[model samples]
Target: MIGSSHAVGTDAGKSVENTFTLDYQVSGVSQGTITNDSAYTGGAGDPSPVIDPAGPTNFTVDRMIDLAVTADNSGLVVPSNAQDRILQYTITNLGNDHQAYSFSIADVAGDDFDATGLEITYSRAATDLNGDGDTLDACEAEIVDAPLTATVPGTAAGSASYTCDIPADLPFTVELSGDIPDTLADSNIDNLVLVAETRNPNAWAVEAVAPSVGGVTANDADGTNTITGLAENVFADGTGTSEEADKDGRMSAQSSFVVTSPDLVAEKRVWVLRTESDGTACAGEAVPAVEPTTEYPTPGACVLYTIEVTNTAENAGSDAENIDVSDILPENVAFVSATTSGFNIPGTLTFKKADNTTNCDGTAGETCTVALTGAGLAAEVGTTDATAQLYIRAIVR
Candidate 1:
């Protein structure tokens, strides 16, 4: 067909290359003898007639390839000692041929709490947030999380205690899906995540990527390799002279990470439980302890001490240990009926939440006290408001 072009595996009307050839000869009588000689060369509707016994123009298909990659750092936040912190990235193949990509990582920022010691993993292909397009810029969406962290088979999801050594060396691969150009013309993204148990109680960022460490190679069904010498940085449109245009498709990204060691804080409050001329009152209803007006509690006035403990950081792997709260009652305040809430004191103590008013110590004049060890602390604090705090109370003479 004249003026038509064809690409490998492309439909008759789809290929844009000028590779179609047309040849023919005249068979009508000429001076009592038949003279047949004609051939032509053309592409996309431009065919030229050549005198033959002469020759038809030879046509060659033009192959092209281009690749570029980048990372996404939008609204990404991670806490230290966290099992795994995921970093997202988008890869785009700007070439005309379908491709399979290899991956690697570059610990951009190195320090005492670097991700080098964490279990670094690359996720399987993620759905394109931008749609069926080759470049991430073509679509609009915050590519932050992996719907399912299943990238490499057999690898369960999550980051645990950081036991990995620094200078983590990892390599992975992913082959794209789809057989048609339109279907194939979509962005291939990855859920590059890092898991660690230990990190400096500070803030930092880490980056990783998959570089084109090698060249491209493939064979056509017609029995000939149409592409060669296409290095990692290839430009189908004439060797993209500058290496930048033909980069080996390497993309890396960084995410904010903060190692927050559990910090324990406390708030101690006192209120006058009741006022008796010489002693205490009924436990059913007592007045809020007023700040002692005198040096200490008067003859009938007593104090209700409330202590609250809070763990000011989110912990997944290494949690706060030995969380305890204690206050030796005033040397002369004497032990009175005490009530413990949200705590498990040792010695088969009645672990009650509220309204369990009973003295922790029986001594009438000696220093009375309330104490609970690591295991006795009920609902030990964590970062979330749900787990971040716990409290206890006691009454003393």
Candidate 2:
């Protein structure tokens, strides 16, 4: 029965109007989850992006490691006669970075440290990492190879120290070895350096000494002879000092020694004693008298007298002695003997006898025979040339 009530509703339905509203919440939307499925699915999108942990922070080195040597600050001091000396050294690491380092020493290759005269040993602590006193092989290593090695604790480094025995008489050289990663990174580090020092001593020296001579005696007619030892009769001329021998030491003196044997009578025979440093035979001077002393010549007639003279050159170890005789033949008297002693003779005169008949054997006192030749002999005779010397032997009788 849609009768009367329905009639009112039909009219309302015919006049009714309809209205609609739409709203959307996007907050719930997110990048689609990425599932670990073997095959790709069309509905979901790619997963969320990811950021990698920052790469290792730029590598940093707070400070570089350094190596240095410490020993006798200025240098080593050695005694004059010292044969060997000990030298010590401390190696330090001045750096902030932990380092692996090493050290070594060797003669500069072809060069020599003169170990022959030196006694060398390494400190036990320097060689052993555990500090159990032991020699390190690195201590003996040379420049051509690696020397010391150690892994320095982080931010701190250890020391590799050693000692060397050097010769006081000679020179020495030192070198180091090991990896210096920072300074020389690519290949094995080969840095070559040389060190050295010297030692020497003082010296002493001596010089030659001279001697002096005394007067002599003579006989009037027959020949008289006397002998004397050079050492006892002679004295050193200058400072009679002695010294030790050294590098540039020296000594010098005059080798000339003198002798004076005189002529007493006009026909008097005289002979001279002479010897060499080696005690060898020598030549003699001869003279002849114009007037016989028996004639009783006038006072200032330049009385003729015969005299003999002898000279001996000393050997390396010997000295010369001067012998003199006087009283018989006064000054300015003419000498007729084969030799004249105790007087100065000029080179221009014929004083040396042709046969040297007046020459005396140093060992024997002999009479001299003489004959006058050339212009009659002139008196005053002496050696024009004088030689300074040292004598090893002498005879006084």
Highest lDDT: give the candidate number. Answer: 1
- Once fitted onto the true fold, the runs of candidate 2 whose alpha carbons sit more than 4 angstroms away are 1-52, 60-65, 95-120, 124-397
Please provide, for model 2 over 1-397, each residue's C-alpha lDDT reduced to its tens digit, 9 standing for 90 to 100: 0111221122111222222222223576644433333233333453442222331122211111122334421123221121223344433322221112222232223321222232223222222222335534342223122223322211111123222211111112222212111111111212122111111101000101221111110111222221211111111112111211111111111110011122111223322222111122112211223323332333222222333332221112112223333322222222333232333332122222224543323323332223222222232223222221111111222
Off-target runs (Cα >4 Å) in candidate 1 are: 1-63, 109-112, 116-397
* Cα RMSD for candidates in order: 24.9, 48.3
Q: Ten residues in a row with the worst lDDT in model 1?
A: 176-185
Best by TM-score: 1
In candidate 1, what are the lDDT values of residues 1-397, reduced to their tens digit?
Answer: 1112223222111222222333454574222211223423244543344334533233232333333344454223333333344444444433433333333333333422333223233333232322355324311121222122223322321221111111111112222111111111112122233211111111101111222222222222254443322222223322211222222232333333333344344667766554542323434444343454543445545555666554433534334456655565555554445444443432232322122354444345454445545533332334352122222223344
- The C-alpha TM-scores of every prediction are 0.29, 0.18
lDDT of 2: 0.23
Q: Residue 351 CA error for candidate 1 (Å)?
A: 42
